[model samples]
Target chain A: MFDLKPYLEVQRQRVDASLKSYLGPEDASNSRVTQAMAYSVMAGGKRLRPILCIAGAQAVGGDHEAVTALACALEMVHTYSLIHDDLPAMDDDEKRRGKFTCHVQFDEATAILAGDALLTLAFEILATTASQCQAAEHPKWLRAIGKIASAAGCNGMIEGQMRDIAFEGTVISIEQLEALHGLKTGKLIQASVVSGGMVAGASEIQLQALGAYAAHIGLAFQVADDILNVTGDPERLGKATGTDQARGKNTYPLLIGLASSQHLAGQLVDKALNALAAFDKKADPLRAIARYVVERNR
Target chain B: MFDLKPYLEVQRQRVDASLKSYLGPEDASNSRVTQAMAYSVMAGGKRLRPILCIAGAQAVGGDHEAVTALACALEMVHTYSLIHDDLPAMDDDEKRRGKFTCHVQFDEATAILAGDALLTLAFEILATTASQCQAAEHPKWLRAIGKIASAAGCNGMIEGQMRDIAFEGTVISIEQLEALHGLKTGKLIQASVVSGGMVAGASEIQLQALGAYAAHIGLAFQVADDILNVTGDPERLGKATGTDQARGKNTYPLLIGLASSQHLAGQLVDKALNALAAFDKKADPLRAIARYVVERNR
Candidate 1:
C-alpha cells in the first residue's frame, strides 16, 4: 500500500537540487574540466543512494535537511565509483545511465581527474558540513563522514573492486561473490543509512538495526541489478543489457540462476524488513525501500 | 647545527613503526589488501611532509606526538597520489623511488586498490584520532582532517592535476605552472603544516603564519624538484632524470631557465623563513627546513 513513486519523485528532486547547489558554479576559466565534471554529475540517474540517505535519516525521526550535505556526499561517492568503473582500465563500459560514460564522453585522463575530483569533493562536502554544524554536534557528524570515507576508501569498496577485477574471466564462489558485493556495494549503502542515523542522533540500538537493514537491502539491490542486467530491456535500462554475461563478469545471476537470484532477492528484502522490526511505523519508508530494491526495473 | 639527518632518521623510524602497527598484520586472510597497503606505505620515502608537519607543530610549541597521526595521514595521502600517478593510464612510470612501481610489482588492479586503501586508511586514522581525543580537542582534529581532505580533494590538488594533464605538450605561462604546482604539490604540503598547527592548538595568528610558511616552502619544494629532475644525479634520485622533458610536461626549469628557477626557489625559501619571523627560537627547525628545501642535492 506504500506508494513509493511520489515519495521517490520528491526525494529525487530534493537530491538533484541539493547536488546542483553542492557542485556550485563551474569555473568559466577552467570550463573544459569543470564542464566535464558537471556534465557527468548533473546527468540524470536514479539518485537512489542520496535518496536512501535522506529516507534513512527520516526513518530514524531526523530532519532530512539536516543531512543534506551528507546525502550529496553519498551521491558523489556513488557517481565517482561509476565513473571509475566505466574506465577502460576497469569495467570498460561505454555507457552509464543511458549516456556515454565520463571516459567516453571526455578523454580517459579527463575522466580520471573528474572521478578523482568527485571523490575528493565528497569528503570536502562532509568536512564543510561538520564545520558548519553546532559545536555539540561536530563529533557525530565527523563520525558520519568517517563512515562514508571508510566505505568509499580502500579497505572497503576499492578492495572489493580489486577482487572483482581479479575474479573476472574466472568462476568465483558464491561466498567470494557475496564478500565482493559486501565491500564494493554494501559498505557505501550501509554508510548512507548509518550517516543518516548519526545525524538524527539515533540510539546505538537503532543505528545497529539500521545498519542491518541497509546491508540486507544493499545486497538485495545488487542482486536485482544483476537480474536486470540479464533480463531487462536495454532501452529501458539505459545501459547495455546482458553485458555482465557477455563480459564474463561474476554476478548473482551468474552464480545462481535468474530464478534463484530473484528468490534470494526476495529473501533479502524480507531480512531487511526484519531488521527494521524494532522501529515504529515511522520506518515505513525504509520498509518500502527494501521492497523497492528488489522490484525496481532500473 | 641541528643535525637534521639524525632527526629525520628518528622521525622516519617512528613513522614506520607506527604505520606498521596502524596497518595491523600482513596475513592473507584480511591482510592481502592491508599487506599491499603496507608494502607501498612502508617502502619508504623522504617523509618530508610528516617532518614538515612536526616542524609546524614545533614552531607553535605544540606536542609533536599529538600531531603524529595527522603527520602519518599526510604521508598516506602523498603515497596514494604516487601510486595512482604511476598507473599505466597516467604517468606510466614503471619505477618509483628507485623500485618497481606498485602496478609493476603487483598487478595494476592491485596497485589501484592499494592506493584506494591507503587514502581510506588515512581518513580512518584521522576519524579515529578525532573520536578518541578530548571533547574540546575533537573539533581541532576534525578541522585538521578537513584541511587535509580539502587539500587532497577537488578544487585543490586534483584540479591542479587536471590542468597539468591538459597543459601537457602545450605552451603554458609561468603563472599556470605556479597554479598547477600550488594545487598538485603545494596543497598537500600546506595541509601538512596547517594540520600540524591545528593539532598543536595554534592560535589564529600562528596558524595563518604557518600556512603562509607552508605555501612558500611548498612552492620552493616543487621548484627544487624541477631543478633536480633536470640537474640532480640520476642514481641518487632513484627515479629517471629529465622525465618532465621526456613527457613534454611543463615544470619550473622548462618554463623559466634553470638559473631563474634556482633564483626563484631561493627567494621562496627566504619568504618561507620570513613568514616564521613572528615565532621565537622554536621556529628554528622550520627555518632550517627552508634552507634544506633548496640546498639538498636530492
Candidate 2:
C-alpha cells in the first residue's frame, strides 16, 4: 500500500525548501563567484541524498531541524562533486539535470570556486550545527559530518572516480566494478543513513542494521542506474542514454550481463529488506526505499 | 636576535613526521585514490600554515599537540588549494616547491582525487579529534572547525580566487585588491589564530586581538610575496622571477611603486605587532612572525 511517488515528492519538497534557505540571498557586495555558487546550488535536481538524510533521521525519531543543516551540507558536497565531475578535465558534460553544468553556465574559474565554496560551506554548516545542538549530541553530529566528508573525499568517492577514469576503454572485472561503485556511490549513501541514525541516538545494533540496509540499497541503486542507462527513456533519465556503453565505461550490466545484473540487484534489495527486519513498523518507509531502488525506471 | 630558521626547520620536521603518520599505510585494500592523496600530502613543502597554527596555539598557552590535528587540517587545505590551482584550467603551473605539481606528477584524475582526499581528510581529522577531546571542549572545537571551514569555502578564499581570476589583466583599485587578498589569504590565517585561541580558551578580547594580528600579518605576507616576486633572487624563490608581470596579474609593487609597497608592508607589520600588544610577553613569537613576513627574502 505504500506509494513512493507521494513520499518522494514530500521529501523532495522539504529538502528543496531547506536548501533554498541554506543558500540564502546574493548580496551586492558578493563577487561573481558567490553568485555562481548560488546558481549551481539552486539548480533543480531530485534532492535524493538530502531527502534520504532527512528520512533516515526521522526513521530513528530524530528531529528534522537537528539534521537540517547536515542535509544541506550533504547536498552541497554532492553539488560540488557534480561541478568538479563536469569540468573540462573530467566528464566534461555540458549539461546536468536538464540545465547547464556549473562550469558551462558560468566560466570554468567560477565553477571551480563555486564547487570549492560549496564544499567548505558543507563543513561550516556541520560545525555550526553541531554547536547549536545539545552538548551530548555534539559528538554524534561531528562524527556524522566526518563520515560524510570522508565519503565525498579522496579515500572514498573521489578515488572511485579516479579508478573509473583509469579504467575507461578497458574491461573491468565484476569485483572491481563493485569496488568502484561502493566507493563512488555507496559511501555517501551509507553516510546519509548513518548520519541520520547517529542524530537520532540509535543503539549500536540499530546503527549496524541501518548501515547494512544502506549498503545494500546503495548497491541496488547503482545497479538500477546502470540498468536505466541501458534501457531507460531519455526524457525520464534527463541524460543521454547509451553513453555509458558508447564511452566504453564499465558497468554492472557490461561485466555481469543484463540478466545477472538484474538478479544481483534483486538480491541486494532482498538484503536491504532483511537488514530492516529488526526495526519496528516505523522502518516501512525505508523498506519502500530499498524496493524502489531496484524497481524505479529512473 | 631571534632566528626563525632553526624553529622553522624544527616545526617543518614535526609537521612532516606527523603528516606521514596521519596518512596511514598504503595497501591493496587502500584504493589508488588514497595513494595519490598520500603522494600529494607527503610531498614536501615548508609547512608554513601548520607552523603558524601551532605557533598561534602556543601564543595562548596551549600545547602544540592540543592543536596538532588542526595544524594538519590546515596543511591539508593548503595543499588541496595548491593542487587545484595548478590544474591546466587554472594557474597551470607545472612546478611547485621546485618539483612537478600534483597533476604533472600523477595523472590529472589522480591529482584531482588527491586534492579531494586531502580536503576530506582534514574534516575527518577534526571530527575524530574533536570526538576524542574533553566533552566540555567539544563546542569550542566544533566552532574552530567551522571557522576554518567558512574561511576555506565559498564565502571566503574560493570567492577571492574567483575575483582574482576575473580581475586578471584588469586594473583593480587598491580597496578591491585588499578585499581579494583578505579573502584569499587573510581569512585562513585569521582562522588559524582564532582557532588556536579558541582551543586555549582565550577571552573574547584576546580572540579579537589574535584575529587582528593574523589579518595584518596575512596581508603583510602577501605584500612581501609581491615585493619578492619582483626583487628576490630567482634561485631562492624557487620559481620564475616576474611571473606575475608575465601573467599580467596585479601586485602591490605593480599598483603602488616598489617603495610604497615596502612602506605599506612595514606599516602592516607594525599594525600586526600593535594588535599583539594586549597579550603578555608570550606573544613574542607572533611578533617575530610579523617581522619575518616583512624581512624574509623568500
Candidate 3:
C-alpha cells in the first residue's frame, strides 16, 4: 500500500529544496536573469520528471542521493522548454503553472536569457556532478549526461518542437501527432528514467526495460493530459477545459475518438506495468505513478 | 618563424570540416531547425574560439586531435550566442558574418529553435566526447566539460550579457565597461583556452599561465573591437563604422579616448605575450593569435 499522494508530496518537497539551493540565494549583484530563472522554477508543478528519475534509481537499488542533482537538472530542462515555448514568438502563452509566464512577468529579452541560462545550467550541473564523483563512477555520469543531452537536443526535443510549430493550423495524421509527442514530450521523459538507471549502474538490459516503461507512461501521460483538457472539471483543474480544441492543437482525443484515447491510455498503463515485471517490489513507486498518470484529475 | 596566416587558414579549414560533419547531412526529413543551424554555423567567420582551444592544447604538449571535438563544441556555443543575440527581442541585428542573421534568414520561431539546437548540440558533443574516451581520460574530459559549461552559463557569459543589456544607453564607467565585456565576451574566451588545457592534462601552473594569457587576449580582443568601431574602414570591415557610438553603446573608446583605447589594446597584447613566458615555441600560435586580436582591422 504505497500511498502515492504522500510519496509524491515528499519527493516534490525534496526536489523543490534542491532546486532552490542549486539556483542559490538571490544577492543584489545577482542579475535579473537569475531572478527570472528562479521565478519560473519556483512557480511549482507536480515534479513528475524528477520523481520519475528518483523512482528509476530506487527500482535499480541505487541510492536516491546519487541522482538528486541529475533529477533537478531534468526539471530545469523541462522548465526551460516551457519558458521558451511560452515566448511571444512561440505559443505566445501568457500563463503557466497558474502564474504569469516569464515573458509576461519580465521583458522578452530577459525571459529569453533566463531560459537560455537554465538550459546551460542543466549541463553545468551534470558536468559538475561528474567531477565530484569517484573516478570509477565518471563513465556512469558521463553516459547519463550524454543520454540526457541527446534527448533534449536538436535531433530529439527541438525537432519535435519544430514539427509542432510547422504542423500548426494544418491537418496532421494521428501517426504524425503521436510521433511529434514522442519526440517533444516523450523523449525527455524517457531519458529521465533511463538516465537514472544509468546513474545507478544498471545493466544494459535493465536500462532497456526502464526505457520501455518510460515510453509507455510518457505517452499515457500525454493522452491523459488531452483527456483532462476535454473532460476535466474546470474547478478541479483550475482552468477551463476544451482550450486544446479552441487553439486547434493536436491531441490524442482530437485525432482519435475520446473513447479510444481513454482506452489507449489504460492500455499504455498496463504495458508500462508489464515492462517492470522482472523487477522486485522496489518498483512499486513506478507502478503507482503510471496508474496516477492516467487517473489524475489535473 | 611561424607563418601565422597559413597556420590559421589550416586550422580554420579543419574546424569548418569538423563542424560540417558534426551537424551531419541535411535530409528532406530534417526540420528547418537543422537547416537554420547549419546555415549559421557554416557561415564564414574568423573561427577564433576554436583556434584558441587548439592552441591551448598545443601549448600543453597535447595533440590538437585530442581537442578537435571540444574545439568544435566551443564554436557551436559561440554560434548559439550570436544567433540568440541577434533575435528581435535582443540586438535585432539584420546581419552577421556577412549573411542575414538567423532570425532574419529564417522565421523567429525557427531561429530560436536553431539557436537552441546548436547550444544543446554543444553539450551533447562534450558528453559524447567524454563517453568515447578511455577510462583514465574520462576525468580530464569531464573537468573540461564542467569548466566550459560554467563559462557559458548564467553566472558567467549569460550574466555578462544581462549586464551589457542593462547598461545599454547609459553612461557607464571604464571599469564597469571592462567588467561587462569580461563577462559577456571574456569568460567564454578564457574558458576556451583553459578547458583545452584541461583536456591536454596540463599541470596546474601551466593551466594558470594559459588562463592569464587568455584573459589578456580576451580583453584585448574587445578593446580592438571598440577601436575598430571608432576608426575602421567600412570596406575592410564589411560594415559601417562608429555604429557603437551611433547606438550609444558603451565602449572603451566612448568611456576613455580613442588613443587611450589603442594604447590599452597594445599593452594588453604585450601582457598576453608575457604571460606565455614559461611556455616553449609550441606557444607561438597563441602568441600570434594574441597579437592578431589587437591588430586585425576587422
Candidate 4:
C-alpha cells in the first residue's frame, strides 16, 4: 500500500519545521503580527498542497528534499488565502481548522496585514530558494516561482475570488462554476504539480502529463468537497454541513444531483489515476492520493 | 534651473501608458476587479515613486528603458498600498486623490480584491521585466525582484503596517514614529531607489550613495506628509486634512510640533541634495525631486 497517511504525517512535521525557521515564531520588535502568522499556520491542517508538491517531484524521479522549500511556500500561500477568505468583508467565517479564524482571534486589521504579509512572504521564500539552488537550476527555480506567482496573482486565485464574491446571491451556470474553481483552486493545484516538475528539471512533455493529472484531481477535490459540505457529519468534518447550500454557492451537488455528483468525483479520480500511467511505482503516492480524495469523508 | 516638472510629467505619461498596456482598462472576462484596479491607478497622481525610480537609474547612467518596467511595477505597488490602506478595516478613508476611495466606489470586497490583484500584478510585471533584460543581467533582475519583494513584504512594508495598526490609540515617542514610517513608507521608498539602481547595474559604491540619498528623502517625504495632513487645504491635497490627528495617529506634527517638523523636512532635503553632489548633472532630477517632495502642496 502507498500508505499516504504516514507520508502526510511525516511531511506535515517537515513543513511546520521549515516554516518556523523561515518565518520565526516571534521578533522582539514585531511580535504580534509575527505571532499571528505563525499561530494560524501552525494551528494545523492536512498538508495537502505541499504533499502534492512532494509527490509531483517524486513521480518525476526527483529528490523530495529539493522541493521542500517550494512545498512550504505553496502552503503559506494557501494559509494566506484562508485568512483573507475568512475576513468579515469576505466569507465572514468565524472558525477555520477547528479554531477561531485569524480575524476572529486577532483584530481585523492585524488579520488583514497578516494575510498580506503571508502572501508577500511566499515570494520572499521562493526568491530565497531560487538563490539557494545550483547555478544550473537557478533559472528553473525562477521560472517556477513566476509560475506560482501567476497562479496566485490576479489571473488565477485572486480572479477566482472576485468572481466568487460577485456571483453571490446571483445565478451562475455550471460552466461558469467550473471556470470559477479552475481559477480559484485549479490553477494553484496545477502550479504545484508544474512547479514540482520544474524542480525536477522534467521535460516539457512530462510537465504536460503532470498538468493533466493535476487538472483532473483539482476538479475532483472540489467535487468531493461539495459533496462533503452537504453530506458530511459535522463532528468528523470539523464544520457545519450544508454550508454551500446555505450560502447559495454553485456547487457540483447543487447543480448536479447528489448521486451524480458523487459519480462525477469517482470518474475524475479515475482520470487522475490514468494520467500517471507512464510513471512506475515511484508515483504510488499520487495513485493512492487520487483514490483517497474521492473516498475520504473528511 | 533644474526643471523637474517637465521631466516628471513626461515620465508620468510614459508610466501610465505602459500600465495601460500591461493591465488594460478592462478585461472581457474579469472587468469589474480589473476596472477597479485600473481606475485608482490611472485616475492620476504625481507618479512620484516611478519617477524616483527613473532618476535613480539615470544617476548611474543606466538607460531609462531598462528601468521602465521596474518603474511601472513600483507604481502598481504604490497604488495597491493606497487601495488597501483605505479599506474599511484600515484607515477607512472614503476619498483619495480627490476621487472616491476604491471601497467607496466599488464594494469592500471589490476594493480588497483590487488591492490584492494590484499587489500580485506587481510581481507579474517584475518577472516579465526580468525576462526582457540582458542574459548577464538575468541574475541581477532576479535579485532586484527579491529585494523589491523583501522591501514590500512582511519584513518591510507589511511589518510596518502591522505595527501601525497595533500601535493605534497609544502614546508613541518620536523614535517609534520614525521606525513606523521607516517600514511603512521608508522601506518602499528605499526599494524604489534601490531597485532603480539595481536595474542600472550600479556598483556597490554607487548603490550606497543612492541609498543614502533615498534614506534622507524617504523620511523627508513622510515628514512632509505629516505636516500637510495638519496644514494642507483639502482641495489642493485631494484628501481631508487633520484626519491624522483626528484618528490619533502618531504623526510628526503631533510629536514634534508643526514648525519643527517643517524645519526637519528642509534639513532632510539638504542632506538628500548633499548625497547627490558626487553624481553628475544626470542626478539633478534626484536633487530637484527631493526638494519638490517637501515643497509641493500635494
Point to the candidate with the largest lDDT.
3
Q: So what's the TM-score on candidate 4?
A: 0.96
Q: For candidate 3, write residues B90-206 as lDDT tens digits.
A: 888898766899899888999888888899999999888878888998988988988888888888888888888888899988889888888888989999999888888899999
List the lowest-lDDT window of 10 residues for candidate 2 chain A: A22-31
Enumerate residue pairs that collide in model 1: A154-B117
| Residue A204 accuracy (lDDT) in model 3 | 95
Ranked by lDDT from best down, the candidates are 3, 4, 1, 2
Between candidates 2 and 3, the TM-score winner? 3
Kindly list the per-residue Cα lDDT of model 2 for residues A1-298, writing each as its tens digit. Answer: 6777898898777777877777765555556777777787888776777767776776777746767778888888888888888887788899877778888887886787678778888888889888888899987887788788878877678877887888889998988989998988898988888888888788888889888989998999999999988998888767789989999989988888899889999999999999988787667778888888887853
lDDT of 2 by residue, B1-298 (tens): 5567887888788888888788865555566767666677776876768878877877888755758888889999988888887887778889876778888877776776677778888998888888888899898899999899989987677877777887889989899999999988889989888887788777888889999999999999999999999998878766777899998898998999899999999999999999988787677767788899888853
2 against 3, candidate with superior lDDT: 3
Among these predicted structures, which one has the highest DockQ? 3
**CA lDDT, candidate 3, residue A254:** 82
Model 3 per-residue lDDT tens digits across residues A1-298: 7789998998899999999998865455556899899988988888999999999998999955758899999999999999999999998988776789999998999898898999999998888888888999998998898898899988789989999888888879989988998999899999999998889888999999999999999999999999999999876665668988888888888888899999999999999999999999888999999999988833
The candidates' DockQ values read: 0.61, 0.80, 0.87, 0.62
Per-residue CA lDDT of candidate 4, range A37-81, in tens?
Answer: 887888788778888888888888895565989998898888988
Q: What lDDT would each prediction earn against the true structure?
A: 0.83, 0.83, 0.89, 0.84
Best by TM-score, which number?
3
DockQ, cand. 1: 0.61
TM-scores, all candidates, are 0.95, 0.96, 0.98, 0.96
Give the residue spans of candidate 2 off by over 4 A. A25-30, B1-3, B24-32
lDDT of 3: 0.89
